[model samples]
Target: MSDYLRLENVSKTFGGIRAVNDVSFALKQGEIVGLIGPNGAGKTTLVNVITGVHPASLGRVIFQGEEVTRQKPFQAARRGLARTFQIVQPFPEMTVLDNVAAGALFGGSPEGLAEAREHAHRHLAFVGLDPIADQPAASLTLPNRKRLELAKSLAMNPKVLMLDEVNAGLNTGEIDTALDLIRRISERGITILLIEHLMKVVMSVSQRLLVLHHGALIAEGEPQKVVNDQHVVEAYLGEKFAKRLKEMGHA
Candidate 1:
């Protein structure tokens, strides 16, 4: 696979606090990347930087061989970079179909809506949301609403899709649905950058894992290896996590 998205020497600060500190990584075409970190670890900040929600304080964002640093959200969308928020925002008044259709209509091309809707329908199907096509987006359950979020982002036809906690607030069954959706998405050739706390979800869905702590990458590797790394264990599990893991035969 070729490089689809790249972030180099990226940094962001709020006053004196560095939200992201010299973070750099490259995402390959069609690779599902798991971006993991504890709260306030700047995982979401990195996502926002790439999506143009918050411009990078320093560094460059390259997409498809071109520099896109500081580009507007709409401009990035036009260039096939789309992201789903941690908070689901839907037009409560609009039907599921219409809500997703708007993504294709606005984010992609006016001419793309008709085509985008067809694609949207398939994507909704991929996310297991087709059965409620005519229902108002606000009426769905939380898990399905998350699916709608994925569908809406899919409708944008992004080359690099950034998903922030798409699996949060889900039950076991709902998480199964989310995993299936993510698997199908990767199968369809959409490169993904997911920031999730669910170890099960990230372990199963991502092809590679990038672990961040305090806005800097500390580990990068296959999921299993990274999970057991001393630094990774410390980041997720407190100081005694190693001993706990040994008691459970994980160490």
Candidate 2:
């Protein structure tokens, strides 16, 4: 597959602090890549820079062979770069269907409300939320809310979807469901950048893994190899536990 998204020496700074530093990677078309790191590892900051929530302080953000280092969030969406937040925030007063409809409209689709609704319902049904599409967005449970978020993002008709902790709050069963949904999405030929902290989830779902430590890309390769790297084990899994797992021939 071709490189659909690329970040070249990207860095993001806030005042005196550097949140992301010289991080660079690429996402191939139709592949699911996992971005994993410990808390405060600047994972979200990198995504922000890519989607234009915060432009990179240095380097370029390229998508589909074009430089978009300074494009705004809406522009990113219109360009088929879509992302889900770590915290799922839906339009509180709107019905679930309408919330997704808003994504289709604002995502740069030239469709009117009627056409947007038509698209939204299909996405909602795909995410298994069509049963309660008329309910207020605020009324759904946590798992269903996450599903609604996926539906909203899908309604945007993304070519590349960056999922930031989409399974953050789910139970084991819910995570299984979410995993299935992600695989189905990938089957539709959408490239996925999954930002996750769960080792089992990332390892199982990712075709490749990128590990970050202190805002730097510490490791990137096959999932097992990256996880076994001393830097990744030390920074993410901690030295002591990694040693134990290694001793047991598990890591």
Candidate 3:
């Protein structure tokens, strides 16, 4: 695998506070990389910087060897950097198909609405939401709504998909289904950056892991190794537990 997306010394500041601090990493093509951190660790901020929701205060974002640090959200999508929001917010009044069609039309750069809707149908089927394509987005259950979100991103023909807390509100069975969907999506050659809190989900799905704390990249390596790092364990389990693990030679 080769580097598909690279961030060089990325940092983001909100007023006087730094939300993302000199963070740098790369996503290799056709790999699923998990980004884990405690709440307020600026994981989403890093994603925003990559997707152009918030331009990085310093450093660069390179995609397929091209610099895109200043691109807007729409431009990010058009460049095949698609993402799902932690909060699923589809247009309530529109049919689910139309909502996904909007992504295809606006970001996928299809020739017209007819071609966009065609792409939407294909994506709906991919996410197992084809049966509910005509229903209003507001009517679906939470798990189905989450699947709809995946469909919308897929409709954009993403090369890299940043999933922010996609399993946040899912039940065990729903998460299993989602895991399967993610694997299937990966099979299509889309690189994934999964920002998740669920250890089970992240550890199981990720090929590699990146741990962030206090807006900095603290650990990056294989999942088990990263999870056991002193800084990562300390960030999640507090210094006492981390010290205990160190004493036990588990850190």
Best by TM-score: 2
For each predicted model, how many residue pairs clash, with residues at least 3 apart or on different chains? 0, 0, 0
Off by over 4 Å in 2: 240-251
Write one digit per residue (lDDT tens) for candidate 1, span 76-180.
888889999999989998989888898887576657657767877877887778988989988988887888988889888888889999888889988887777
Go through the candidates in order and give each one's C-alpha lDDT: 0.85, 0.91, 0.91
lDDT of 2: 0.91
The sequence of per-residue lDDT tens digits that candidate 3 reaches over residues 67-136 is: 9999999999999999999999999999999999998976857899889999999999988889889999
In candidate 3, stretches whose alpha carbon ends up further than 4 angstroms from where it belongs are 237-251
Question: Residue-wise lDDT of candidate 2 within 1-251, one digit each (tens)?
Answer: 77899999999999989999999899999999999998999999998999899989999999999999999999999999999999999998999999999999879784599999999999999999999999999999999999999999999999999999999989999999999999999999999999998777887789999988889999999877886898888789887766665566545
TM-score of each: 0.91, 0.96, 0.94
Error of 1 at 205 (Å): 2.0
Among all candidates shown, the one with the greatest lDDT:
2
Q: Could you tell me how far off, in angstroms, the CA of residue 4 lies in candidate 2 after the best superposition? A: 1.0
Assess the local accuracy of residue 115 in candidate 2 as a C-alpha lDDT between 0 and 100: 95
